[model samples]
Target: MAHAARGADAVENDAEGLRRRVAALLEAHWDEARGYSVPNPSIYPHLWLWDSCFHAIVWAALDDPRALRELEATLDGQLASGLVPHMRYGDAGPDTWLGPLERTSSLTQPPMYGHAARVLADRGSRPADELLTRAVRGLDWLWERRRTELGLVYVVHPWEAGNDHAPRWDDWGAPGRTRADYDRAARTAWNKARMHDVTFAADGSAEWSSSFVACPAGFNAYVAFNLAELAELLDDAVLAGRAAALAEAIDEHLWDEEEQLWADLAVVGGGASARSPTSEGVMPALVTTDRARALAALRQLDDPDRFGAPFGPANVTRTHPAYDPDMYWRGPAWPPLSYLFWVAFARLGLHDAAAGLRARTIRAAWRSGFAEYWNPEDGRGLGAVPQTWAGLVLAMGA
Candidate 1:
């Protein structure tokens, strides 16, 4: 009894320490402008879509009022067409490429606002109706402006995918190309698309003029899951149906039967490109209702040579030629992604796996003081120190 009591006391102390650290980090990054939360105070001063969503989620876990403000501030940056920019910079920042035009980038990150809003609403941080309205608008925007004929939404830029510099974009525009070359081609395609007046049509079709587009499995899964959550919040049958259909489309189009995993497909010249697999590809399994398929996908997480590295689930698989432990998204283990997979594992009844991952993540954060990511091989923290999502460890523990 004495030993068990001591262990329990240690756990409580650790939890308190995590909560204190997260609260301090959140306070540090809270922008005065409508209480928007930045991903990092220095490295990423701008309000990032997914980062804000994550910030709100962790805040909601603590029942903080800043949670509501974070979502509302992000909503204020939404465009008239319902497309929320991936990054919204404050007026004081150094001039960026988009400074000549709108301060917000035309591109967008994963549609996670709906998911974040739903989480906040569930925690009673905001009114369900208000959050539902905002979420539906964002969903409608994606369905109208980003959806392809194949029934999946496509991202026009690598940054918009939130897995910038990932191996998946290595051959974005042309095979055997460098990152700089791909960026130039993507930029040129984006400009042409904008010049041609690409916009969402009244008939639910996108008047796209860009050749650079990709339907990433992980991104589409996130959209589908969030749409389902929004549908439940709003009790909207149409959105629910669309969400189901989208999930089906992802399975049909992105799942590789032989590999037993989900992969990304680039829409090039109105046709599907070859399949590209990354650690993000496993995300679809999180939302999959098909037991067999979900189990198969989860199996990849247990493969030591693949995602089950000592400190991973690396961002890219170990077997991939482009695997580099120090590279940002190419192979490093991010806390956000690890937390997400932990949730998925728990939901899928892989409780032991989930608990193990949670232990690893907590230890890594404790060792590194919330670094952006960790080296999957050595468990060494990398990237921005004291990252916002790295503080997500607090919520994960809760």
Candidate 2:
């Protein structure tokens, strides 16, 4: 909070110190045998899709070769059909919900490796040529297989949106929102009831669960962003066109002008999306074609009544009935998400706002000791301590 009042030189110096601390924490979370940074050595103990992507970006910013190794490690357990699983257990042991034989998750998370690869190359690191090809395979697979009729990448689970605790999926529970009302037990039950809907093959591909097949604005924005960047890096016209079309589709179908935020489109049509204003709702600014729409969505970050926390953007509106500054995914200021907003803001020429977020995020990461997420209201650490993704503030402030 003081960052806004502090002199620019002082803020930059403070950020450099925070960067050093984050770099050390990232190193501590690195799993040598696994070749990737675990989210939290104690709590998570496994690699995740978007987390590793954020780690790679921070690693590259630090000039660490681990950045390349992290990306390579991410390809492990990838399906033959090019679906990049959201989680890879390796020797850490499969999660109980994943079943004994299953290692990688059947579902995919937000696709950000393409954007990570671009960040790596931008840093002058020649990630193997095959890496780009591999990343595109996953994107292509989503477009061909998981795409809803809306032309947006359809995600089967809320985890794919990476905002697991957000209220968008509250319809799953009736008196309790399908037990999704901050109840992990109920959420798990809700999951098992329909887990059999999708049948997996030997190749790790599954018939996607159609009941929850919805296009989340945040998820598709990352896909569209990755495609657009990869297209430029690879010089592919077809991919470029697809990226443009995807972005345009997000505008045409998902933009909720009244909310000034992108709303997740539920195909089945029951809840109408709860209309909960989430930080991820602004993610479409990364790829949306309309400058006015992008600016308006991004300015939500500057509004105190909405996302304007002293730390990075709040996970939800402060006015929301369920806003929780310390709850995971409820309203914490996550470094990776803040980093995304910073990038999006800068891309649209909102440099001042982006800089404020950069300072605030780095400060929060510092004060929270690189926790998994921080209290949006007070910058107190919550969730896993010394998590690697918080290190992403290095790249954000840089």
Candidate 3:
């Protein structure tokens, strides 16, 4: 028993070291001269809210006020309707997918302002009104935009959806991935099938890497939680009424009676004919409502056949054939998704569930060394171990 305890201690120490190193990588990779708005860590050397929020988590430790500033810096990029694009382009760097759009357009992530806002909420220095007001603006944007048919938020692109391949996609055609460039079709193909199409094995040595694609689960769940909070925070009775109505609509519409999992949307139309049970989809229960149906959706987690994992929740249920343990977003225990689940459970008063998941996530992070994603069963680090968001979750215990 003593030896086992020592082993556990050693593992914890190794995990802590990895977390520290990941944080250092984030700071070092940050293009400070570019005003901190670009060159984010998670999605590559570009400014992305997904990375920025996690970046805020670490910066919170170094300087709480600066952490809040980090979020504020990203806010400046909001589009006309307050739509925050998933990413903003920095000065020329490596040629990457979504590279062209990043240079030309201004887009944002799903409204995850609440996560960042709550972080600011922890800092008494920022005026509550200021923090709440900015957060409310972002929430208002989500209310105005991003909703799909049947009231659930509709993310136009995969990046916004976060959990790319929920079970629903199996019925529709699998999402086709693009080749990286003329030089690396095989590597890109390998990435499309095995990795998240973001990275791949340069020479087949199990060296996990990523490219510039986004995940659907990360963004969908973000809006689910943000909108739920907006329903509570909107000051105007009319706006509050609208927010509540939208929230309820989401619950009713998204609560899939058949699968018992929330799908991205019913993809009947030719353009949107790809439905999936993205990790982000489960977020309605995780963040918005605590109804029995929502809870049932989470029960999918225990479906040893579907999502149950020794480390943390897999991005997709195992019942799906696409379920590849090493596939980046397809089947892995990711920190950000788990962190969102952890907090969502807490918000819904499921403290025990939240704590249990938190503990599991911490262990997974330690075991996987804070990788971008880990094997759900073996806890081996998969893509970009020491990815920014994984480290952020560990540091904040989110």
Candidate 4:
């Protein structure tokens, strides 16, 4: 018993140390003169909206005002069309950040602007109406760009949609694209699991190995959440009306009743192939969705042999043949995935379930010491150690 106690104590100490290191790393990487910038390891000044927002929450816990500043940097990148370009070119070259032209795909990820805005509100960090308006405009942009005649936002880039590991990619790659076509100079140094086409660049930025397109789950869920919040804040019934319609459409398209989960569409036959379903699916319960059928669809959340592992939620459903615990993006126990599940449970009033998942997530992240991703069955770390987003997720302890 004494030995067991000692072992437990050792693990606790290790977790505490990791938390501290994460805090320090965040502080060091913060570039105040440049508006509290946080770069993806290999590239600098190419701002990412979701990543910065994830870090901002931790910053809010530490210094509320700086957290607000971090968000400003993200908002700065929003285009006139309400499109928040995935990256903000600061000093990096074309080779960095996936060709650096704000992507050609008309559809981009639903910027979870409302969530970030709400976070700021929690801290009493108010900027200006202009900022909020710009965010809203970005949402409007989505309604225009992504919404099809069917009203569902079509995701053009997997990364833009925010479900980076969506099962759809395991089959059909980006719409009519291949890894060899990517500019090698833009590969991010921080991401270890990449298939970069080039080793070097003129601007010292490395490129990526693989390119992906159009996954819809997280992007729509986020937009739905944003629209809901906007409806409340602005009394814009039109916004809410459109958002509701989009939600219904997304449910109809993405929810595979047979699989009982949310997944992105996959393309077949290279660039010329038609879109199909991929096995890399995640539970819709990961995000807040109010469609009546959503709950029934998520019943598979705790199926022991499939997704319910000793850790927490796995990005890919365990039943899928492609479920590999060691793969970088496919079946990894990612903090972002767990983060969404934590929120979804809380929102649904599944307090007990939420608390349990939160604990597992915290345990996994702390144990992994903020690795970029982890093995689904064990808390062993993999990929980038002390990753910024992982640390932020850890600090968000449920």
As for model 1, its CA RMSD to the true structure in angstroms is 5.5
lDDT of 4 at 293: 49
In angstroms, give how far residue 122 of model 2 lies from its true place: 0.7
| Model 3 spans > 4 angstroms off | 1-26, 35-43, 61-63, 93-107, 125-135, 165-221, 230-239, 267-275, 287-290, 395-398
Model 2 clash tally, residue pairs: 4
lDDT of 1 by residue, 218-315 (tens): 88888887888788777889989888988899988888886688888877432332354577888887677787888787777768777777665787
Instruction: Determine the backbone clash count of candidate 4.
Output: 20
What value does the lDDT take at residue 357 in candidate 1?
79
TM-score of 3: 0.75
Per-residue lDDT of candidate 4, residues 103-161 (tens digit): 32222444766666766666677546887788788788777755656566655445565
The worst-scoring run of ten residues by lDDT in candidate 3 lies at 200-209
TM-score of 2: 0.92
lDDT of 1 at 129: 68
Off by over 4 Å in 4: 1-22, 37-45, 94-107, 164-166, 173-215, 265-292, 297-299, 394-398
Which candidate should be chosen as best, given TM-score against the real structure? 2
Superposed Cα deviation of residue 278, candidate 1 (Å): 1.0
For model 2, which pairs clash?
Answer: 172-178, 173-177, 173-178, 174-178
Candidate 2 global CA lDDT score = 0.78
Error of 1 at 312 (Å): 3.0
Model 3: lDDT equals: 0.55
Show model 1 residue runs off by greater than 4 Å: 1-13, 92-101, 173-209, 269-274
Please list the residue runs of candidate 2 whose C-alpha ends up more than 4 Å from where it truly belongs after superposition: 1-12, 99-101, 174-183
